[model samples]
Target chain A: MLSQLVFGAELAYGTMLYYLVLFLVLVLLIKVFAWKPINKMLNERTQQIVSDIDSAKQKHQEADSLAKQRQDELNKSHDEASTIITNAKQAGQKQQEQIVSDAQSDAQTIKDNAHKSIEQERQDVLANTKNDVANLSIEIASKIIQKELKANDQKALIDSYIEGLGKQNESR
Target chain B: MNDKISTFFLGGLTFNIGNMVAATVAAAIVLVIVVWLSRNLQVRPTSKKQAVLESIIDFSNTTTRGSMSDSDAASFKLYGFVLFVLIFVSNQLGLMLQVDVNGVTYVKSPTADPMFTMTLALFTIALSHYAGVKKLGFGGYFKNTYLEPFVFWFPLALFEEFSNFLTLGLRLFGVIYAGEILLKLVGGLAFSNGIVTIIGLAPIELIWQAFSIFLGAIQAYVFVTLTSVYINGKISAE
Candidate 1:
């Protein structure tokens, strides 16, 4: 209940100037209050979104390259393992062939030696049999000559003794 | 109250006129709203208050940029923003508020004053002239704006300046003043102790008040849009 102050409705130059000045002040104040801060915030938001997209792209590319590196490493190890296995297999094959060839050569040498010893033993046995035959012949001839003293009478007695000795020797 | 105007005299050659309290109150209300909305503005702008302020600033920027040259967009936006708030708030002052202190009734739009609207129009023209001068040099601006398109058209161009002032100020004053008077008459009907008050006045007042809001916004937009157009005319050689 304090409305005793009455304002005249006349158009005053001072009042017009007052309003213009007021408008000028209001314009300046609005720039401070809403315009500057709002624009700044909007610019910040735009920059933030752009930077976020940038960082996300960077991270995605990094992940892609890392995955490729991992795949490459896996492939390399896989190839290395297969190569090592192949090399080991080839070495094992060579060792096995060498061992088998050496054993075959040793077996062949032993077989040849046994064959030469058998041939020598057979030749020696034949030579000894011929000598034994010659010795027997000489002993028979000497016995006949020594017994033939009287031609007719001694001939029948020597023949009978020689035949009896031959019979005894054959039985023994 | 034959005329509901309160006049205050200071000391010498200056005096306050045409609802100083109402104008001050309108300005203060806008100031408070602007400050309150500006508080805690965020990059994301979650609050409706912040959203409202952001939209206003954005609209002003876009409108200024669209209507005027790229050079004047920044400075004119400040002028446009302030004018919009002053006119819009003052235009909508009498819708739902009644500030009755003692005997005097303080109701009506501050923009209903011809002096106030004319003052803004004068500023718009002055700023545009200054912009033209700054762009083309004083001699070039004078020649281009007044002396071009034949030598006799200089008087016509001078008359055009007066007309710009007249049209811009009068249009705003006419629309807002009529709206305020209509609201006053309708408001009187509602308070009158009669069956007609209940049956006729209240409903019509409600509908008219609702429509007034839209009218007030349109008037404010028109004022700013015309200001931009006038400024563009003065600055551009065409």
Candidate 2:
């Protein structure tokens, strides 16, 4: 067998041609049927994966920005709410001060009016008492003088007597 | 030692019928497997078959890319894949079954024959030169292939090309042929004396067969790798 392998081995043109034709045909068929479609599919899958990853990243960034925007709005509204509450509290304080001041002034005015009216009533009562005393004195004097004297003489006497009584009362 | 190959003469030219038949069988097997595996392929692989096919493609792509630029790798990846599949199937075929009828071995590994391997090597070398010439003009291709680094390296480079051609084919032919020879020798022991010899040599035959299968796979991978390397050497400036 070894001698045959060494001595009998020779190149054959027909076999070479046959193999060449077969190989070329095989390559052609594989290129058309297998390699083209398979390579295309692989490339498409790679591109799809890349694009999918890109879109996912874009969505993540969008979600992040949206969350940030919502957070900012929440912070802003929180600030506005606090400011409104402070304003309402301040307004209520002012209203309370205004109401207290108004009530105080009204009480002062009513007290002053009450004092003036009491003083006026006291003056009216004193004047009426003085008029009544004067009338009573005059009536008493007329009753006493009527029983003691004639007409012209009684008038002169009574005046002199009254005058004498006023001088005597003043000296006493 | 008395093995014979079937042959015929047509128009005063000798044709090796056994090698042709074996090569055709190997080619058919490869085609069927490739076609079946590649059918119904999806972007997202659903079946283990698809995964296996994708990995095989990926492996070929990576092997080619390892020796060439991306653009070159892309152009040649399918060639690399086809070469690997064909040679691998051819290498393992003899391990599965070797048929002999009336002192003539009709079926065996096609790669075991020098003619077939040399033919494949010639094809690869021719393709590399074609690619080199296409990428670089003829003058540039000659200059790059024959004269590079220094003018003094020309003789060495020329010798290297001849040796490369010889070695590429001979290496595959040697390993596969040696493995088959050893397998046959061990198998001969099983039928040599009696059942005692058969039972005793069964383990050795099995081991050798297993080793031959491994060697076949390795040779196939080596052939593809070297092919890309040689092609890359031709096409690329560096």
Candidate 3:
């Protein structure tokens, strides 16, 4: 009974044709169902990866440029600050020099005015002293002349008396 | 176990129809599964079924590409993959579709039939030559194939052509038919004894069934490999 399963092992032309058709149908179904879709998915994945890398690179370059711009602005502000400080320092120095020169000129003017006033005061004192001394000497000389005049008049009167007595005696 | 595919007389050609019907149904089932599994494929495959299909495609491409250029590999890999999956599945049909009709057991492995495999091999070899002719044109392909190194090689080349289909078909038929026979023998072993037969036959049947699946898959791989080799032979040697 089991040996009947062998069925003589005969090859057939009709079976060959049948299997070929079945095989081709299976091939067609598989091509439609599996091959096209899987390849599409793979291609989409590849494209997504490539575009991601490109965008990332572009963003990195932008960041680098922005950082460079920030650095430039910082440097420009620093230079501007330095220039402002330098200008302020020069203006302070000029103010100090002007103050010093003004003080010196003021002191010189005060000193010259004081010297002129002192010279005028000394001349007034000298004139007052001369007048006082001249007055004092004139007073003393007048006293002396007064006393001498009295004495001389007395002496002259006596001499005149003597002379007149002599002249009268001569005339008589 | 019967190797003869049931047939009917239609018009003039003896239409081989029963196993053809069975095989068509099996192929349709395969088609449905393939379509369903791959319908919503993702770049990053998520489901187990999707992953399994992807792995098969990947392995097929890798192995098939090993022997040929990328372009040829891409084009021919469809046939390779389709043959592998379909034959492998049909070979295992012996496991699933065993049935009794009027006290006779029938298993539905199309590849188990020598004629079926022989026919597939013939088609594959014929297509390979066709591809060769298409690639090199008729005269160039003829000179390249038949008159390669010398005219004296013609007989040997003809022998190679006949032998290619023989080997391709016989190898698969032998393995699958043997597996079916072994399964039958192990089933018979269970009938002869009590403890020893029970334990021994049960384990042997189970292990053989699993191994048979592995064997069937390997045979399918071999079939695809030989087909590609034949195609490469015509494409490259020219």
> Can you list each candidate's DockQ?
0.38, 0.47, 0.44
lDDT of 3 by residue, A1-172 (tens): 4323443444455666777877887788788777789778989989989998999999999999999999999999999999999999999999999999999999999998899889888988788667755765676577567665576577765576557556744673
Q: Residue B16, candidate 2: how far off, in angstroms?
A: 1.3
Model 1 / residue A40 / CA error / Å = 3.2
What C-alpha lDDT does candidate 2 achieve relative to the native structure? 0.85
Best-first order by TM-score: 2, 3, 1
**Tens-place lDDT digits, model 2, residues B1-238:** 2346668889877798877887888888888898888888899889999898888888878877775779877788888898998898999999997777787676789898887888889988988899999989898898899889888889999899888998999999999998988988888878999999999999999999899999999999999899998998999886
Q: Worst lDDT window (10 residues) for model 2 chain A?
A: A1-10
Return the lDDT, model 1, position A162: 71
Q: Every prediction's TM-score for the first chain? A: 0.59, 0.71, 0.59
Candidate structures ordered by DockQ, highest first: 2, 3, 1
Q: Which prediction has the highest lDDT against the true structure?
A: 2
Fraction of native Cα-Cα interface contacts (under 8 Å, chains A and B) also present in model 3: 0.77
TM-score of chain B of 2: 0.96
Worst 10 residues of 3 chain A by lDDT: A1-10
Instruction: Flag clash pairs in model 3.
Output: A5-B1
Docking class of 2: acceptable
Largest TM-score belongs to which candidate? Answer: 2
